[model samples]
Target: MDLSVTGDPVLAQDETEVHAGIYLQKGTLTLTRKGKDFVAYHALVMFASANATPWAAQRVKFTATGPDSKAVEVTVDLLNDSWDGPRAGIAEAIWKVVALAATAAGDIGITYAPPGRT
Candidate 1:
């Protein structure tokens, strides 16, 4: 996504908060605190497993710095049997973080106004 905050000549330094809810067939995904200038953070918890596989709830948290930093943190809660399940959980976490960031950046773009343009 093109998440540039420089195009708007009148952007402010205040932090902005953005959130997104992602619904997948087998998982309840949520992305929050996206975009803005200082940081973007997200958390996801998978309550159930796919196809009765008995997976545990997975939690992931990430913080991105500035309007360009792609910093991310991920945490997963899984049963021993599912801990190494093809890295799907980690992948999902990463995806959610990016999605959250994009959503936030989009919001910034939509709400941005050059200091003297409006």
Candidate 2:
């Protein structure tokens, strides 16, 4: 694949793969911003890349909920970007629900066990 940077330069390129053909990017994206105080809380970026169809995209589709039961989906377009996917581990939680890190498939979604009840 041919990748290039215009102004800024790429720091490093990881040969590691989160999935099959996905690689982590070790670089900074150029920030062309104006003089304005755009108050923000938190932000996230996700990228997905794969050659195989059908199941490839599914692996990157990390879905979650927002403040008001709103559906929040984060995933990179494997076909479009033709690059790496999101961070190796996609962690998302629903509003009012504690989405713990991936321990097991059973420990993915919301928990009704309460704190320290497990």
RMSD of 1: 18.4
Q: Give the alpha carbon lDDT tens digit for every residue of 1-118 in model 1.
A: 9785655476432433233333233223333334444333444433333443432233334333444565544344332455543233344544444344444445433232111223
Q: TM-score: which candidate is best?
A: 1
lDDT of 1: 0.38
Q: What would the TM-score be for candidate 2 when compared with the true structure?
A: 0.19
How many clashes in each candidate?
2, 3
Number of colliding residue pairs in model 1? 2
Using Cα atoms with residue i matched to residue i, what is each candidate's TM-score against the true structure?
0.22, 0.19
- Which ten-residue region of model 2 has the weakest summed lDDT? 94-103
Candidate 2 lDDT score at position 99: 15
Residue 32, candidate 1: Cα error in Å is 20
